[model samples]
Target: MMSEALRIAETFPGYSREDWAAMVEKALKGQPISRLTTKTVDGTEISPIFERAVGKAPLAMRPQDTTWAVCQRMDHPDAAKANDQVLNDLMNGVNMISIAFAGSAAARGFGLAAEKDVLAKALNEVLMDLIAFRLEAGAAGDAAAKAFSDVVADKGADAASVKVSFGLDPIGCFASTGALPADWAATLVSTIKDLKAKGFKGPFITVDARPYHDAGATDAQELGAVLATIVAYWRALEDAGFEASEALGMIDVVLCVEADQFASLAKMRAMRHLWALLLESAGVDFLPLTIHAESSWAMMTRLDPYVNILRETTACFAAGVGGADSVCIVPHTIALGLPTSHDRRISRNLQTMLLEESNLYRVTDPAAGSGYVESLTEETGSIAWALFQQVEKAGGAVEALKKGLLVDAIAKSNEVRGKLVATRRAALTGASAFPNIDEKDVEVEAVAPIALAVPAAGESCTPLKAMRVSEPYEALRAAAKAAGNPPIFFANMGRIADFTARATWTKNFFEAGGIRSLSDKGYNEAAEAVADFKASGASIAAIVGPDGLYEEKGADFAKALKEAGAKMVYIAGRPKDIMEALSAAGVDSFAFESCDVLAELIKIHDVLGIAPVAKAEA
Candidate 1:
């Protein structure tokens, strides 16, 4: 009553940053503070503790409304079917529709046909004045824009009331497909003029950075690409006789929201900060940055498609809390095939639950003033701004791509990420860790194959390839499944306590590659284990035991399994001192913590006659 704030302030002494650090250090029991630091993929070191930001400008103003638009991607090839899906989505909860056009690089070979008839059919019952529409037409964006305009006119909707985005990103197309269908400058001029003539008020040109993000770019690199592309568009628009402010108003930013929730949230906030700073530098009055956040395709997996639900949920939450103007949650079964009605509904409802049930939309800039998030936002923004300057120095985004500078940088980051995935340093649930070998194939609608646009002659550049982190491991699983999920027998040496841990580890390890393990109970003798292994008809047998037991009997057990018809013998634990003896006695390899899981699985596949399918060179 004297005032709650005054009471709390009187009860506790204010703690300084150093004081907090001292307490954390003391709690660590003399461990270095650096031990608590985490290095992000972008090479930014994030400390565990952060003091309140001092003399730092807020990233962006809080949204006037707490809620964000629940956007859904509508990419079915059949326009009628797409329209049905759209109506269903809107009726359920979705307020925004992203129309992905066939042959758009962002569509990854799946989308509605880019025709006026198809556009009209897809938007047949959609209320243009109420719901938003975003077009992703890639190289054909200009054509698609005209078609959409025709549909709106035919629908008798007021053009000014319709919330639509042309989704024109020429640099994104070039980076994705290694070429542009038309000259970049010519395409931009024509598209901008057409939209301006139509009197469209929505952001017509989209500066999409998804190509970079899906290509395995770090947060800094993705943000840098967006900044560079935004600047490039501004310069182009000015050259095409548009005012700087008008050009800025015509553009929007689209970023990928991935499974790393905190990182995703930080990235969204950082991009807003970067854009505000860019506009401030240009002396343009602040215009609200329109951002469209979509769940990352690179994080989806075909092996365990259901896990993608959790991934997309976290992504949607991050986008909403991070202050995205709109958020699109990709269907969980997207990687398997064209998403079925059920798949789309589930994804859409998850967003609804987050907004309504969870009430995530009740706060604007939810992460604002949080020490860790603020620190991450600042660090991420600083790195991104520096990279943006590098692009400017190398001539803007187009020149950077033409010179292979952007592609090379992204490839380097991809190399690091690829290594992390292969070694299991980065865990992909149900793919790289705790995989379910008996997982049923996800059912999806049977749709026509995606049609990709062919690049025209004399229009070529280095393309940044998009890849999923689970592909390599998924390939290994597919190979094993193709081989009828061959069994790997585990020869448990000694009592249950002596071998259970290693046996479980070995079973999960093989199952991660889709190879089922028939694990036998404790075997006191090598002959008994050998008999069980032979009876199980397993081509591969793993010797599982504690280090002490391995030192004593691992060699004899490996030799026995080899004699009992095991094509290869694997040791579950890594006892370096006894490795030589076990190998000499017929142990083929050892699976242990920190080992290269992908490489080891491939080797096992080779020994079991499971030939992996050839992968195309990126």
Candidate 2:
């Protein structure tokens, strides 16, 4: 049967039986497989060999000890309430705060308020005292930088404890801005030096590869861009008078985490190994890289917003298990408009719940044992390392960037991926798979855009684009809650040859409703079997082998079953004459392999309100 199935599948061209067999073989080998069959990042043949030995090394970090934070970007229009939300989040277990400041306007609600003194004062009052503040790339703008300096200057070198990131890449900024300032490199070098001098250890000079990933670049392209960029940073810092080790020490790396669990997991592990090698090659001991991941903004969709919860959960879990030091979940409604306080809370809680409940962080290097994961990790590391070497040969990362080689590589990868997405080969659930036209009806707080306007003392201003209420996942949770726990049951049968297959099918049907299935051995008395089913609350029953028993006691047994008040009796392969004779016995149906038997059984169940006990047909 299996061979025939394979042959038909190979010839059908509709579905590959080889694919199915590969998956089945994998399942047989012990690793659980999802029903969906999608290609891995490397575009290699599918195999199911998972490693069970990779977790030997204690992971440097664990999510169980530290939960990912639920941070809202406080670029809101109002600085103070953005501050208020920060305090609220901290009080509710949100431990990290990240701010994105492009200018005075961007920093206003972040407490910059266009006045360096006031901004510093507000930041110290809100974030310094309440939560860990993560400074985004633009947060290092002259005004914002000075504001940060003032806040930490008083604290001196101990200011290292204050978390901050400078998304400093003159090239990245130039790419976004469409032109590089003549002194951009000078400014980045100076920023790193100044921040280091002020005792900011691990002050991030981002190798922001998210843009490539978001743009649909393959894993290799994304890693390549980052390697190239890191080389640029290394050279930039060394030229600015920092020793190689000091320069390497002055910066930390950040990578994006995606929903593809194994790919994301392998990518992170491979990255760590690569960073260690890179630092070794540069003759510097590698430092602990700090990766703060946000749910990919690019993957969110405007359609079928509810499915975003599933996406975010998967992404957040990936980020945490990928060993991210911190993670921020984007609200499901992000693509719709400005996020509300509730949206932020939900996003935060998503991380909170997963860490606390799922226990994903208890074990370190969770992907270590899987054959697929290890192989993929090695493959990614090799590809990325070769690319890094190539970049060094091409006058380094900056030159590669300037020549658009990295961009072109990403473009080619994106083109391949775009084709996959278009063909539904890469499923984006809400956007491409099952679209929802009805707007989600959750009551969520509306968030305005970040407002940097300074309000008069004691006055308040809302963030830009802030308004309304929306709760995208609330409805889903409510529905799930309402459904409650399903019931459980057991199936009992009387005969094997006569009713084995039918009993198995019936058991599966009932089990779908959470019922269990058990069959009576041949020695069990009919009455005893019925009694067992009754005791187990198995309201449904099947009587089997009446035809074979008829020469001896079939008639008497049917009469006894009727007298015993068996509600539904199924007679297996009863002769026509015997069935007629037994018609008055109230048998519900006579079962046989007519190919249509399964369908007929379904119809009977539907009409009789018989909820099957199992989810699958035996």
Candidate 3:
């Protein structure tokens, strides 16, 4: 093949790195180039531009190929329905299925029964030898694993040929549930020994990252946690008389992908690097480790679930592009309740389109050679390895969790990110930004939510509960619905054109906290606006206009709205040196970009006498 330089176009002007920097400085009006750079949660510095590299190497995939399993989640409570969905998915496009049992972290609150007869029914008429089963059971890991083993044994299938990931993750279970059936180290060793002895040639044990990831672990922390978990498990398995090669072969790696496509892709690829590094340090050959991904449940939103489809598509595509071996595309409506069959089909179709239509699985290591992504992978791996060493020094993931090191880290990071979410700094499209107050409800099945009990086995720690980014804002929206969508008067200070932009922004801004915007842009006089504000029946009001208009009539409008029985008054835009005057004239607060939106909304709820809505989902 001819190189690009060899066939260069003679008329095109070439630019060097210095030329680009000079141009950027001029564009920034003498500002430093560092202003264009940002940092990730792991403290990796990200530049706005990158130069082409002379030499780079591609990271190898598990099988040096791009084909991945189109896996769907099957969590219907009825065994017959689960079986029917499985058959339908297989018939349509899915070749793999994940069975999330009741009380498991995977399904949130709905899942199948963990019994042999029910398990058999769930697999009725399906060929075990052809289809792969990924288990999504938590704390009930023992019973669910044994029941599936019984299904494999009694169904006359060749256990050696059946593809199953039992997904017995005791460390992950303990992290989530805070209780293990017994001492976790011994339980895991005995369970592995028992499963291997049962003649199930398996990728039986998993280092599931969902618990820590959902609990708000950063990307580097997640990769580090995965590395630490794999090391801990292999050490235990080797001590239990399993060969290094055999132990490595028995392990499956699970991760979560979110809407941040580039970061998610880099995180997935970084896991592979961490896995290979672990093997190299152990003096074992690189083994095939199946990386299964579930699109992050913590990233899904109940308020605008159709937006969740967009999130799931981007996230699932990243998983495929980063060469995941299998992926479970969580239904868009799962956060609401048990998803309908149609909803399940929509999720399956999304994955199928990504694979067959978009051909995302056709290119192996799609992110391997790009300078930015390669550097991202390196930085992510380095920081993750550093954190993994810290975990090892603290006696690995289990000990770190017991001593509260990991949980504390999660707390500190989540607290920082929570402030971001609370303000408009971290804009959530449907919930905290431009929300759809009139969005019709998306229907979900009317199944009762399940509460799975995890029996205490004398060992316990503080559990890491899962959370979503949009929960706080969504709760306010739910409360607004209960309060009958009370209106907030938008007291536009000047003529329509002068106040349109700020008023529109104010409308979007206030509605984010579930308060509807009752805006009248044509008001030419403060007295007329006050009369309208009184007649509009809104208890609160915001004065919005251009800076000049705000300096002119903003204080008068605030005073008028308050005098017209508005419980609280606000003005948009932090115009310089006039906030004291506005506040004295009855402006209670200010609303602008990067303000504490959740806090302000909660205050609005209190002023409106609306009760706080409890957290609705489990």
Candidate 4:
């Protein structure tokens, strides 16, 4: 058999893979150093994750052959415009539709215009056979309750296999509006009972945990919130004289899967396992759970809005691999304003591409059975399960919510996450670093959060409204342009072994940090390099070559560069007398093999305050 085939055979050998892993670890660990190490918020020791970390879980589920529905969100100021958007998105591979209210007027407009009966009739009439519906009960006030039930019943009349999830919870409502009706729980219970009695097999009771996640809850905490919320519903149903199985059957949930692909993937898988465990503890057998995964709103950014596509893609991929029944990719332009019809179509298309072209939906539980993925699944599931149990023992999710324990735990997790961001352990692309200057401030008709009659309802939308500060583009651009022809110089003393790899790596490292390099083929002679540096007015020079060159020509090269008027020179490897020679030559800084070049570039950027600019037109 081929070597590739042999490697596969080796992985599934008769003995435990742990033995091989141990041997590999021993071989890999040739030396140990006292470097700073960090741990996850849950106190789990953070280690480099690879394919090897996955072990012994279900590798992939075969029946996940069908792609999930890509839902396009509609929240326009006008009903006809929103309806037109819904039609366009549905035609363009959007199998699901989520309607959100941008304002109280918007919700009222949708309610009054699409009038409970007319709206339900139109929704029932218009939604194509393949499309499902999600109603985000905005601040429609008294009209919300009737509109919700009417719409669900309308979908039911056609016997069309469409999903209808009404984000109807008194606590969620209270959180948004700070006005909870006295009959909030009673209303919800009645709605769930009504849906089930009407033979609606779709997830009738959606536990919206996105609020908790957007509020900065950890994955474990988010899962805990979901479970606790489910438990709250379970207790409420039981108090309403429902059986365990009935309550379990009525429960559905949505979770916020972030851009941290691996963690989010693990979180999704763990969610299923956690739900299974919760049901088992409740003396209920397996009941199918439907989970709708949304991209993390907290991680969305206004600057470099294009990067949001990358974020949403990974979030969608993670959700898909983690087995979410449905995944919603929010538009990149959503942060600026009410999303355009085009934006919604593109967002929906991302998932369509993943499923249809990328073949992501061909396998269920795709990350299963890997040593690392399985380990993460087990670990995350176990931790979340424990938290769920704690929440249940505290008299369920509602009690925890009422007493503020759930919020308190989430606050603690957010604090840790905040510290991680502050300390640079967790870097937010485009926002924390690599900010965009030419970017425009996004202005959109804001989606005023539906006020829930509860505490923390609007907390999820706070980050959305916060203004982001970035340096003015023209000023920064002018500064960068003024700095002009910022130096391109490389340091090499003489012919050296492995010159190719060293140069390639150095060039790559520099380019990755958004700096120009002065490397090219056939520039081998030190004199020629020095001449080019002089001709180009190079201010900084980097020496990347073998130690032999440093030994043979270090002193002479330093002396020559100094006489040639090079301001800063960096030597790749340590010379026999680098400090002495550089100090003698009056060089600004000397970097050895142990130096971190990226860190060095950051330092340079700080000192110069020189932003990057497009090369000036000749």
Candidate 5:
């Protein structure tokens, strides 16, 4: 007897790739097939369709079982408070804790003090053997690790049962802060030897690519950095009396997961594939790769912060489905201040829902065997491998940083990303597009100021700057919020049905800059709109209507609004043919799709006598 899938397959003859292309071209109505393609920042081309081909190998596979640790970040400055939060998280669904030490690159501006007394107090009530612990202590990782070991000893837990990662990435610290505190060789050897002597049988070194990612490196660049950093660690460990396999077993990789779901998934798979290839080339047996993914800090925004929940949820889902061994979801309000207890709960529950309700982790390599994912994984891995070769030729990751090669590449990518954000090519829901002007400000607990570490004065290089794509738009919105009262007025030119769409668009556009827009209902006469515009007391007025109506009454309405004391007049639609006449009648500008929204908002702020505050440089 034939099964259902077998019968269905036999009922249809498979078409060739060319046959599929022909059908797609016909459906496109003579448009070129290339129009359906998109180019990513990493120089990879994504096509609308993909076909299975011979000799295309599958990427590395994840564990078959549905298991991934729900890791939560603990960075409260007070030891007791941090301990309380850790217990609460453990009592909930969280199974892993990542402690950020003060002055670590991963700490950003928040972490617990890295002292023995503080470490003991922070782990007082927690059972070290039951839950996994990962430390992000940057250059101070060795000290933090010793302190953590002391805490475990005090609790009398068997050291063999403890699972932890002493996240020690000296090269990462150098890239982040632009200074190497001590001799890299001495530090690496001493840290590893101390851990081995203490029977610490966990990942001791972290090859963190998050510094590069936060500094605006594309996916390929970030992967290249990770590979290069890992290779450097392997060489250092071998020199310090460890074999290649042992060194590889003692290291782990950390990657940043953002809101792009498919890209994030493919990136994780590509990293594993690249690692396998690297191990094969080094003549070492393959080992399962350990990857830790954290929600992207560069994607979080201070304005309309509630939208960050959606972003974090998507990132967490990607990390889980991408086969990350563990995932951390940063609080939605992290960019503003210390996250409140409620915000922490929201962040933890986001991963819980995705794991328990959505069952995202139930599938092993869910994207495998799909033509699109397979192609993406291959192309992404190839690009990263090539970049790794370039770094190797320039004398490894540290030398590449010292020579400013990696810094220059990251800067170029950052510039391109900034331009995209400015033009709204990269949309930020609450910060750059569709912002709520009347939304109340979010309150958060007060956070302590960062205590910066003093560098020990070795070789120094240019630091990679961390940036948020929405920061520019956020600055403009901040200015508008402080400018007081309604900032703009909408001059509806026709019946409700005629002007509603464009009027709504105009209102949303201005509101994205945090400018309150007072919209009037449909008005028949130019005199009525002019009267309403003057009564609203808004200096900036937008003319909203249909194309036919704009051609009919746009000129008169613009002239009347200027005469009635509107400092600046803007038309919602871009009627190119009548633009000359409209401008002559005092329509200063037009706002439409694909226009430079950030530039327009800045101009509007200038005209309204609102000066934006100086933004902090990334």
Candidate 6:
């Protein structure tokens, strides 16, 4: 087969970058190819095309065709209920479990309290030796780890037979909550000592990127933060009297996987590659780093939450193909409340199908040598390393955060990102974009939270808060829904061909905010549009048509709507030439692509007398 393929390959001529560029420019018709470039928040430009990658080695974590651990998160507050969930998931082919303790970010307000009794019940019938284990305990990490280790011993599970990530991440906890329970170095040393005495060979430290990622840090920022955090722990452990190789083995990583498949895939690959580079630069031997990816909390939507299913699937594929040791799919309904078993089942099945049915694990480092992914990996790593250097210059993750250097970077990125979401530049399907106004309420297991005592403040910086992209849009939708689904009169002014495109877009715009667009098919006369607007009884109105029609009748239509008692008149598609005339004729705003859609929606809501809806915090 190889000889025959090589014989055939010799018959064809190859294309060069110059040839590709000529074609691209011709297709662009005098427009610069730079117009196709997109940028990350860190200002890394991603080109639309690239030549074949050269001299790049594969960075896969596992061997070819090897399946990764299927980790189901155990987070129900009730111990008995959580036990059922764990056993159910395990019985159905899940090979790993991530235990989220109360007060952890992954728990999302509901997790088992780190008590021996609760731990015992949660793992009642499950054999610890049979499955992989992970722990997520924020500032209360020591207590949570101690409690879990003790429970395993009490059940007589041999420590050597079990594979567990202790997941004590003080830097990550402090970065998210702005407080460490104690001196992080002291805490890590004590925790390691206590666990070592119990015969537990450990991946004791975790450098989790979710805190920063959830706080709206871009991929480069999150990767940079993780790199700095891991360096901090490696040094701290060496200082506390561990061998360099042993200290390296004690660390693991967790990164958030969102809907951006190429970025997430590149991020995972870059993480492993970067880790190797970091360790080698410090004169340490390279080890294959263990990475765990969870679907992004920042991308989930409370409204039309099922879209998260699609988002998480794309995320899981990226995580798997990009060489994560394990991937956990956050339930689609998670943003709504505590997920039911059905929700959990759907997530598990989604992952199972990806692995078993879709065969995503059939190839290791699937993105290796691909031009776009390799370019992204290289650029992402280079940008991330520079940021890591910046954090190190500020002393470390803890000190950098304390100085608000990293925090300020996070804030700036978040501001730019928030503007993107508001302007519809970042289209959130089923949330900010094509939203379903009548989506049914999702079900969640109704359970009272296991309230846990928060640790007293150790040191404080400004805490990074988790934010969802759909939040502001959700608030607008909620307000509109509460006001009995307020109507927006569409004073469409043109023939069918002139108005159809803008009218369709205009309808979707208003409906995205839960406002019904009351529009006729087409009305050539201002009198007919005004008559329909007055009969529709909408306080806010929008005029939708082509530029030619807007140039002719736009101002006259705006004047008619205002005279018909429309509180605000909006013109769809900006006709810049007639803007002054429309404004004088009472056109309050212009709605167009890349405009501040959220702000315009809010303004319309104000005219409708709908009170501002307070957003629910994550």
What is each predicted model's overall lDDT from 0 to 1?
Answer: 0.85, 0.56, 0.85, 0.61, 0.85, 0.87
Please state every model's RMSD to the true fold in angstroms. Answer: 2.9, 16.2, 2.2, 8.0, 2.6, 2.1
Clashing pairs in 5: none
lDDT for model 5, please: 0.85
Decide which is better by lDDT, 2 or 4: 4
In model 2, which range of ten residues has the least summed lDDT?
Answer: 461-470
Instruction: Estimate, for each residue in 1-618, the C-alpha lDDT of model 6 and write its tens digit.
Output: 477757866788877877777788889997777789988767778887787788877765887778988999999988999999999999997999999998887688788988889999999999999999999988678888888888889989998778899999888888877876657698789999889888888788988999899899989899999999998998899899989889989999999999999999999999988998998899887777899999999999998888899999999999999888898998998777789999999999998999989999988787888999998888899989999999999998888999998889989998898888988889999877887887787788886554433456677888888788788888888888888889888877767888887888888788788898886668889999888887887888899988888888888888888888888889998888889988999999898999998888887887778897776543
- Location of the lowest summed lDDT over 10 successive residues in candidate 3: 53-62
Q: What's the lDDT of the predicted structure labeled candidate 1?
A: 0.85
In model 3, the Cα lDDT at residue 420 comes to 84
TM-score of 6: 0.96
**How does each model score on TM-score?**
0.93, 0.63, 0.96, 0.67, 0.94, 0.96
* Regions of candidate 5 where Cα sits further than 4 Å from its true position: 1-30, 52-61, 451-454, 614-618
Q: How many pairs of residues in model 1 come into backbone collision?
A: 0
lDDT of residue 476 for candidate 1: 87
- Writing each residue's lDDT as its tens digit, candidate 4 over 1-618 gives 477856876787574555645655666683322122346676555444344543355533224477776876666635566667777776688777776643322132222232465454335346434567766654442345456556655555543254566555554443334344556567667776665665555455677766666666678877887887777777777898989887777667778776789889888888888877777876777877888888876677655667888989999999888888788887776655566566666688889888888988887786776655666677777777777788778776655655566667777776676556543356546544454433455444444433222222322321211112221222233353356525447765445454666766565444323345675533445576678778765667776666566655655666667667776666655565556765575445554333444356555544555765652110
Clashes of 3: 0
Writing each residue's lDDT as its tens digit, candidate 2 over 19-130 gives 7666676866844454333455446434443434454453465444665555656644355656666667777767777666634222222323434554554454454533
Residue 568 lDDT, candidate 2, scale 0-100: 55
| Clash pairs (backbone) in predicted model 1 | none
Query: What TM-score should be assigned to candidate 3?
Result: 0.96
Which number leads on lDDT?
6
Instruction: In model 1, state the lDDT of residue 535.
Output: 83
